[model samples]
Target: MGAAQGDDQDEWSFLFGMLMDDATKRGLAHDELYFLSDELLRFSLAYQGYEPLLEAVADGELSRLRFMHEIWRAMPEHFYVDLALKLGAELLAARQ
Candidate 1:
């Protein structure tokens, strides 16, 4: 269910920017940064929710927010900072 790489980059950039802006203002600690990021991710997933009933129809089919699952699976402890770092690395890797 992943969007195109170009699309994900643009969207992720906006998300990362917004999260960083608030994180900077709050002077959030490591733990708090992740807490805020997780919340933001949750909100994004909630906003994207559309196929609630259809998601579970197939056994192997991905549910909602498949990209999120990808990000989380790549992250350390599912931290937001880690997500950014990993996503950045993935972007860089894509270029090579």
Candidate 2:
């Protein structure tokens, strides 16, 4: 990968780590977080529109929470519901 691409990936990784930390605090299981983070990475890679937002987050110009909010807003409702259900199921399973 080019230096810029590598930089973006590093930034993305940093942002993903922040998100995973937040999700862990909210009680998301490791497996669920893994799947969610993977999905998010895929989404960001496939969508160029999110590059600017990711760049902003990486540059420290935007809060991670705001980055999440923007991503959530952009995600389809059905997609969000599916991930939510999967996460909830994992949480319930973990509790048992």
Each prediction's whole-model lDDT (CA): 0.46, 0.58
lDDT of 1 by residue, 1-96 (tens): 245433243455455455655656787632346343445455544544333322442242532234333333322333556678999999999999
Model 2 spans with C-alpha error above 4 angstroms: 1-49, 75-96
* Reference-based TM-score of each model: 0.28, 0.30
Compared with the true structure, model 1 gives a TM-score of 0.28
Candidate 1 regions with alpha-carbon error over 4 angstroms: 1-6, 35-96
Deviation (Å) of 51 in candidate 1: 34
Clash list (residue pairs), candidate 1: none
